[model samples]
Target: MRLALAAALVFAGIDHWLTPERYLPMMPDYLPWHLPLVLFTGTCEIAGALGLLLPRTRRLAAALLALYFVCVFPANLHNALNGLTVDGLPQEQWYYWLRLPFQPLIILWTLYAGGLLPRRATAVAAA
Candidate 1:
């Protein structure tokens, strides 16, 4: 799960750089320097993703990545609220609405994958 999450983040970060305009609509109008912000967040994502691979940095990376998800949530909300489309692709309101609840799941996943969460072990019965 940890490796998968890392790969996903790396892919997403790359996407931000490769097609930044696709993310522009998600940015709130009040935010300044949209392009730079996108690049910065993208870089952070990539860095965090790489950090996750190292045992010493996994916890910090997980925490930061989880926070990143929280920080960017408004953009997700903005996309949903404004009925924004990506690359001229129309997305139904339900699609965006469904995504809102998944943010927390992603956070939890990161924590668990990073070993920051307490693990429960099942007791084995004596044979």
Candidate 2:
């Protein structure tokens, strides 16, 4: 799970640099330096992915990534609410709406995969 998440982040980070325009539509008009912000976020994602892989940095990385997710949520909302069809994404409105709920799950996944959250303890049978 951790590896998959790291790989996905790496791919997404690279995509941000390779095709930033797709992300531009998601940015709110009030935000300044959209291009630079997109690039910076890409860098953050890559760094966070790397951090997740390291034992010492896992917790911190997860926390930051979760925060990052929260920070970017407005963009997601703007995209969905405006019905903007970003390049390479499903053009269907339902797809955009469906994605919104997944953000929290992604945040939770980051925390769990990073070992920041305690796992469920199993009940041991008394002999």
lDDT score, residue 127, model 1? 100
Which ranges in model 2 have alpha carbons more than 4 Å from their true place? none
For every model shown, the clashing-pair count is 0, 0
Best-fitting candidate, scored by TM-score: 2
Candidate 1: lDDT over CA atoms?
A: 0.90
Task: For each candidate, give its TM-score against the true structure.
Answer: 0.92, 0.96
Write one digit per residue (lDDT tens) for candidate 2, span 1-127: 8889999998999999999998988899999999999998899899999999999999999999999999999999998999888889899999999999999999999999899888989999999
Off by over 4 Å in 1: 88-90
Tell me the alpha-carbon RMSD of every candidate.
1.7, 0.9
What are the lDDT scores of the predictions, listed in order? 0.90, 0.93
